[model samples]
Target: MSTAAEVSQNNNVGPVMRQGELAQAVVEAAEIDNPDKIIKVEDKVAYLRIQTSDEMILKRQTIEEMLGRPFSMSEIEIELASFAGRIDTQVEYIRFYHAKHL
Candidate 1:
């Protein structure tokens, strides 16, 4: 076994964070929604990645159709802007994750 300094002395220095957990979270969420796309979350952040395997883009496009009327571009912008402002005003909780090497 070698210390991080010793490892870094010879090879690339930093530890790599694994994406399995994030991918699993996204897959789980997609399965629950029965989405046609393969969805994935990025780590613990409020981020998502969706791969359009099937005609999954249609599912997203249908949201407006289901609502009967389409919202104007300005209306959508205003709603999203308000949501962002509300999120910015809220308190955020953080937790530390410790990784154990074997």
Candidate 2:
């Protein structure tokens, strides 16, 4: 088991989203949008924790593509239960990141 201190030592950042289609789409989007980063997803039954080291980005376009429908960036709030690190949201993309490396 990992301790909180051990977990916090890494620069992991992303969202904890309600487990459903939207969360699945976001995970797929994060993977596609951040090809350089290793996206991680933790299945918590009730919610899904999607994250990456340092930074994780999800593009609206990628989500739309994953969902096979139009998606609004603001719509993410409906499924966002919590998040790690600082978040930067825009019309085109949402970024979860640490301000600096430890």
Question: Can you write out model 1's per-residue Cα lDDT over 1-101, one digit (the tens) per residue?
Answer: 98886753321111112334423332343344444434333333332333222221112223234334552222222222111001111112111122322
Clashing pairs in 1: none
Q: Global lDDT for candidate 2?
A: 0.91
lDDT, model 2, position 56: 88
- Model 2 TM: 0.93
Candidate achieving the largest lDDT: 2
Give the Å error, residue 93, model 2.
0.6
Q: In model 2, what lDDT does residue 71 have?
A: 92
- Measured against the true structure, the TM-scores of the candidates, in listed sequence, are 0.21, 0.93
Model 2 pairs whose backbones collide: none
